[model samples]
Target chain A: MTEPVTTGTEVPHGGTADKVFPPLDPSTVSPQLVWLAITFVALYFLLKKIAIPRIGGVIEERQNRIQRDIDAAERLKDEIDGAMRTYEKSLADARGNATAIARTTQEKLSAEVDRERAEVEAATAKKLADAEARIAETKRKALSSVGDIASEIAGPVVKQLTGKDVSADEVKRALTAGAGE
Target chain B: MPDPIHQFEVKRLFPLEIFGVDATFTNSALFMVAGVLLSFGLLMYASRGRSLVPSRMQSVAESVYEFVAGMVRDSMGEQGMKFFPLIFTFFMFILTLNMLGMIPGFFTVTSQIWVTAALAILVFLTVIVVGFAKNGLGFLKLFVPDGVPIYVLPLVSLIEVISFFSRPLSHSLRLFANMLAGHITLKVFAGFIIMLLGAGGAASAIAPLPLLAVLGITALEFLVAFLQAYVFTMLTCMYLNDALHPGH
Candidate 1:
């Protein structure tokens, strides 16, 4: 308002009555109103039916698409986690089964070895008893041979000592007594 | 030398008269139509693909949509989304008119107070009708601010009434006066450059100074153009909010 007052006085024709108040022109007002109504109404429809909706649809579509993609990604991540858990569980189960099988096999093998060793020890004890009996028989046979030799020597000595020949039974009895002593 | 105000003079392109009313298709009318057509074309082309991953044009279109949509949602809440079309139309129409006028010879339809006033009237009517329809007589309470003493009620209500009725006038004049003043100032400075150069000698040397000033003012006018359009639409939302919730 102050602008027109200042400029109006400074330049007479520059800020004339028409210039100071352009909208007050009766001819200008009606046509402007009429055209503004018509054009604005037309623009409103264009915006409502075509322009705004188109732009709004694209924006909404982009937002929905992003939301859906994020949701899908989240769901897939959960699935992967579940699968990993299952895989780990199965892996642990397999490891346990392998350990159990190994332990059982070792126990069975050790038991079989202990049984085989017991059988071998029994066979060796029987063989040692048989060998001791054989040695005793051989010692008795050598003692009898010594008695025969002692009887022969005593008979020869008696003959040499002038006329006193001892009987074989008496010499065996003497040798046996000497061997016992 | 073209008169600074002569740019605002309306010339009949098609001398039309309807029922004894001079409804001539003047330069202003032409620009008004041009503004609508330009908005329609740009928006149509921008949203042509409608791809999820938007193209550059689609991005530009969506940016405007989001800007206005957010403004409406913020000012009037979700209920205000229903009026998005009207708000967006005002923004695009006025913005296109303001920008088109920056193109040297083009006329700015928004510079006309009649045009701006008509739009403000539409917004005013919408606020009134919607306000009454939604809240009935309770809408009248908007003028009666709460917590005021009974002694001050009459005086306060009178001031409120005057302010309320002046909404359309202020709304329309804010946009119209800014565009008119900026354009006139630019033209005046531009006219000075021509006048100075025509005088020759030392006067011509000073022509570059005004020429520089015009350049700077032209840049500021562009900024004002966008700002004014944004301000107009923003105020429309605030007024519409008053209709939606008339308590305060």
Candidate 2:
């Protein structure tokens, strides 16, 4: 015990303290084992009954909640997709209806313009015919008047000419001869 | 100046006999009970809240549960879930004991060979029981691995058998030795600092060396404390897997 091993303070005590390594001491073994048995059994029961299940339930419940939340989010996404589809369908239908309405208006306006043009052409032709007929009648009347006027003039000129009371038949015969010449 | 081994000594707390045996409760027993109560109490308190959104402490408790559960699932498959309570108990109890021992005055229960041996033997027994129960006599296939040369199969089987028997020995001793050695090293370094300071002269100037070593070792011991508990439980799972499926 008095041996100078690494100068006293650095000593590794072997013979001192009941001459037994504390970890391998015989007297403490049985007590520790007994208490360990009690401890292990008690801990196992405590964990099995209360601790494990409680913590496990909390964790499991959290996991289930997360899964449910994910499912709900997925469902909402599907609903949004459905709504988008409906919106797109209505948009396409409205576009098609607008095009159809514009096409129908154009066709109706074309038909109306054609009918009005035909009515105008018919009225103009009727007016032209009436004017030509009046011209023809007036020309015939004028020709008859010119013959009377020439007869009157010729009679007056003969009376004033040298008291020559020439007969109308003579005048007429003269005129005819001149014409034939 | 201080006895490093003295920390491992078990003292009589309530000296009483049970059925004519020296079953008087000792300091070692006290720590075991403390470990039990600490583990159980913390888990109990942590899990008390049933909110869908777990509190921080609850989350931690759940992580511990999930950690062991995941380990068991990884090593032993889903069927190993039946042993979850036992495995969880081992990890939490040992971890609690190891951590509590880090406090200056508390006894390190796991430092004792007897305690660690008991734990390892329990796992060993569990493996054997489960192995036989699950595979019947086919559990011996664990030793005789597949694809050994036909002539050396006997030698290989002999080695496997030896390793299989020695598992409990190594398992128990590994934890015990690590804890005992680490704590003793820490105490020894701490003692050196004091011894140098007590020299009261130029040696005191060099006391910072042991102080630094002690600080570093303390950190290492903390890591080792958690690591040992992790390793012990991990092995427990692997052994259980062997029991569940004894094939190579």
Q: What DockQ does each candidate score versus the true complex, computed on alpha carbons?
A: 0.36, 0.45
User: lDDT per residue, candidate 2, B14-109, as tens digits?
Assistant: 776688666778889998998999999998888787777889888888889899999999998899999999999999999999999999878999
Interface Cα RMSD in Å, per prediction: 2.9, 2.3
At residue B170, candidate 2 shows an lDDT of 98
Query: Among all windows of ten consecutive residues in candidate 1 chain A, which has the lowest summed lDDT?
Result: A8-17
> How many residue pairs clash in each candidate at the backbone level?
0, 0
Q: What is the C-alpha RMSD of each candidate to the true structure, in Å?
A: 5.8, 5.8
- In model 1, the clashing pairs are none
Which CAPRI category fits model 1?
Answer: acceptable
Q: What is the lDDT of residue A68 in candidate 1?
A: 97
